[model samples]
Target: MTGPLAGIRIVELAGIGPAPFACMMLADHGAEVIRIERPGAKKGGPGGDPTKDILQRSRKTIAVDLKSAAGIGVVHNLVASADGFVEGFRPGVTERLGLGPETLLKVTPRLVYGRMTGWGQEGPYAQAAGHDINYIALAGALHAFGRAGDKPTPPINMVGDFGGGAMMLAFGMVSALLHARTTGQGQVIDCAMTDGTALLMSMIWSFQGQGLWRDERGVNLLDSGAHFYDTYVCADGTYVSIGAIEPQFYAVLREKSGLSAEPAFDRQMDPRGWPELKEKLSAVFATRTRDEWCAILEHTDACFAPVLSMAEAPAHPHNVARGTFVELGGVVQPMPAPRYSVTPTVAPRMANEQSDTEALLDGLGYAPDEIAALKAAGAVA
Candidate 1:
């Protein structure tokens, strides 16, 4: 608890994907997060190792069965002292459970209630079950991925889930918390993945509106349309990415890759010649290993780097020097980001090593006997 958000407290209704990731970011930056899990919920990381689940780190966990009135009462007690709350259930689910914004805001008037979903709170697809791909597809982002002749490639879950949903929710919660501290008011944040994904494409949309971009997938400059801004396979079957967009950087690319003497490469901005230039560049790149190309163009203004896999990324010299990744509980994972000069963030630890039900109930003003009775009644675990 050393970062800028050290004094803040958040209550997270335990969920998968975006909501958990948002809670993790808040907890990482020193917000004290209490994760409320259901009784008998699975307790392990993605690989069945509890410590390896990076999304669940840096939080205290308590099990409360929301079906019981006593369980709902426990949440209300926690909300009375919490600055914010988060949940990712479908629309109206929390309302049915008596844990909606209207119910919780009555307990703490300044609470920031964050809701995460795919299609959002109100829409034709709001109640339908969907995932990251479906949301980004509707946002016009999925159609912009992949090569010209190839089908749309799902960029895993990064674009919609972590990037759009979790990151946006975290930003909204912090913003709403700031406003609450100033005016003593609370509000709901309807953080839909579809809305967030669309917001993330603002720059691309601008390009299209200005007639600088085409609607096709791989024909845009930032996409894989430009020969100088794509990945290439080398002699060793390893890959390297090039992003020599500026004239100066592209000149360095042409020089270092021995393409300066070729007149065909001079037409860098000609879209009609991109296909031919890309073929020639691919052949040139295949003549050398990825490491060889890195040695030639990596340090130059060519904007080049080897396309390291997850296994190689942590071991890269630049990443190691910056402490970008850390090993905790025998698991290698990324560290909390966006450093603060004054209030440096503390290192994160494994979550839910043991239950905190008794301690939490005690702090909530519940007597030991009452806690025992609630547990006996199958209300808490």
Candidate 2:
């Protein structure tokens, strides 16, 4: 607990995907996050061990049965001591559970209440059941991610869940917390995945507005249309990405890849010649193995990088040199990101449900008998 957010305390309403991810970011940077897991929570259950769930890392967990009045009271008490609260339930779920902002605000006026949802708190689709794909699709992000003549591709939950939903909630909470510190006032943040995803498309939207981009998929400069800005399969069937958009970098790609003399590639920015030039570049790239190309272009300004698989990424020379990944509890996962100069982050620890429950309740001033009584009442697990 020694990073920029060292003194912050957050109460997380345990859920899946984005909610946990958001808290993980907060906790990684040294917020004291207490996760409230539902009693008998079966998430990552069966063969799914909680220790191996990377998203649940770097936090303490307590299991509370929200269905019980005592459980509701338990969360309220925590809220009073906390600086921020995070929940990803549908719009009205917390309200129904008696832990809504209106109820909690009375106890702690400076609490930043963060609500994560797919649609928004007040929109027509706020109550609708949807996942990451559906959320990004509605945000105009999904329609722009595929090759020409191909169906829209889902970027696996990254674009909506982690990028849009989780990151937005984390930022909202931190910003609101700062505001509360300054003004002595807390606020509710309705962080919608759809809105966040749309915000992520701001640069692309601007390109469209300026007539520098097309609405069609795969036809834009940053998409797969530019031969200089796409991936190519090598003779070994492995792939490498190129983003030599600038003329100087593109020259390096041409010289390093032996495509300098090719006439079709002469007009680098001509849209009409892109398709034919792409075919020629593809043929050239396929002539060499990925490793062979990496040797010549990997260190150059060609903006070149081999498309390493998950197993290979951690072993890459640059990543190894930077300590971008770490092994914890015999599990290999990414280290906390956005490095700090002072008050660096501690390595993440494994999550254990109810492991800190007794101590946490004791800190909340629950007598030993009162804690036993709550456990006996089945309000805590």
Candidate 3:
């Protein structure tokens, strides 16, 4: 509770993926986030401990039967004291439960209501079921992946789920919160993964608009098309990434990898020769082990580094030096980023299973008898 968002309070309807991720980010930065789970809902995480679920960490949790009127009342009471709220259900789901934006805004006029979805609140495909892959595919981002001749590859769920969906919702929540604090007028943020994915490709879209980029996969400069801007397998069968996009950086790459005398590399920007140049560069890179090449090219103008895996990334010297990852609740997860200068963030804690239900209700002005009655009636757990 010692970060920039120390005084902020958020109420999150329990969900998977992006919604929980957004709440985790807010909680990591010191927002007091209360997660409401459905009674008897299956616990999620590694094994059965929801606390170990990295995305669910750093928040207090309560279990309530949303079907019960008392449960909706509980949420309304929580909303009255919250600065923001998060939900990831399909459009109209919350409305059916009497917890929609219109209802909550009436309870707290200064609340920022954040809605996360793949399609959005209203659209032709809004009601259709989809995940990260489908959303990014529709956004034109999935079409930009993979090799020149290979079919478009999905870059896991990072692009749509976390990058476009969760992060955008978190930013919207913060921005709307700021606006509310100033103008006393709250707003609803319809954070669509498809829209966010397209926004993420603004640079590439600009390139295409200006006729500087082709509308094909892996044929662009930033894609795997360029010999110097891609990952290469080494003699040891491991990989290293090269990003010598600029002339100076490419010169360093050529010098370090002993390709400086090759005349073919001079046509660096020529797309027609990229395949042949890439083959030649691949052969050169295959001559050395990944670590050997790292020694020659890492920390240089060559813009090179070994392509470390999930198990290897945390141990890398650069990541270790920067504390890019941390161990919490015996779990290794990424640290909260974009370091703050003045109001620094605190270490995150594990998610508890309704450990603070009674306390939260009491704080919300529920008397002891009323809280006991609600529990006895199976409304809150």
Candidate 4:
């Protein structure tokens, strides 16, 4: 608790994916986040090893069986102490659990209640089961991916889950918390992945509206439709990315790549010539190893970068120098971003299961016997 949000406390009803990621972001920046997991849920869920669940890092965890009244009571007590609360259940799930925003906001008038969902709280698809891909598909983000005449590509879960869902929830929570501090009133934030994903595509939609972008995928300038703004495979089967969108940078790419003399490259802005130019650039890039290309263009304004794999990214010279990654709890993971010069972040810690229950309860002023009775009643594990 050393970053900008050090004094804030959040109670997270631990679920999966986006919610965990949002809580992690808050915890990473020095908020005291307490994750409430189900008593009998599997350890780490799909994150494999609990310690290596990067999304669950930087927070304390308490295992509570919300089905039990005593467990619900425990959450109510935590809410009384917390400045904010986050849950990612389907629209009505929290209401059934007796932990809905209406109930919790009454306990803590200044609490910021955050709800993360794929389709939002009142949409027709709100109760429908879906994943990140489905959320982005509905948001019109999925259709923007992939080349012409190819099936739409899902950009893993980043666009929908993290960018749209979690990040938006975090921002909403913080903003709501600021308002709560001034007015002593709590509010619910309905963060839908679909809504956030569509927001992320605002610039693209603007391009389409202004007639600067085409509806087809892979035919747009930023969507790998242009020769200068796409990934190219190297001779060694590795890859590199280029984003020479400007004429100056494109000229530099032409000179460094020895394609300056090629007459076809002169018509860089001609839509009809893009496919042919892309073919020739592909052939040229395939002649060099990825590292060799990096050596020639990486430091220049060619808008170039070698497509480093996950294993290779942390070891890159620039990343290492910037301390972009750090080793914590014997695992290498990304550090808290958007560094603050006045109030720097503390190192992230691994999630501990039920290890903080007693201490957390004690901090809430529960007697030892009371906590023991809570455990005995199967309210907390």
TM-score per model over all chains: 0.98, 0.98, 0.98, 0.98
For each candidate, the alpha-carbon lDDT, in order, equals 0.93, 0.91, 0.91, 0.92
* lDDT (Cα) of model 4: 0.92
lDDT of 1 at 265: 96
Per-residue lDDT of candidate 4, residues 95-126 (tens digit)? 99999998998999898999999999997898
Candidate 1, 246-319: lDDT as tens digits:
99999999999899999999999999999899999999999999888888887789999999999999999999
Residue 347 in candidate 1, Cα distance off native in Å:
0.6
The parts of candidate 1 lying over 4 Å away from their true place are 45-49
Q: Give each model's clash number.
A: 0, 0, 0, 0
Q: What residue pairs clash in candidate 4, if any at all?
A: none
Mind giving the per-residue lDDT tens digits that candidate 2 earns over 195-260?
999999999999999999999988889989888889999999999999999999999999998888
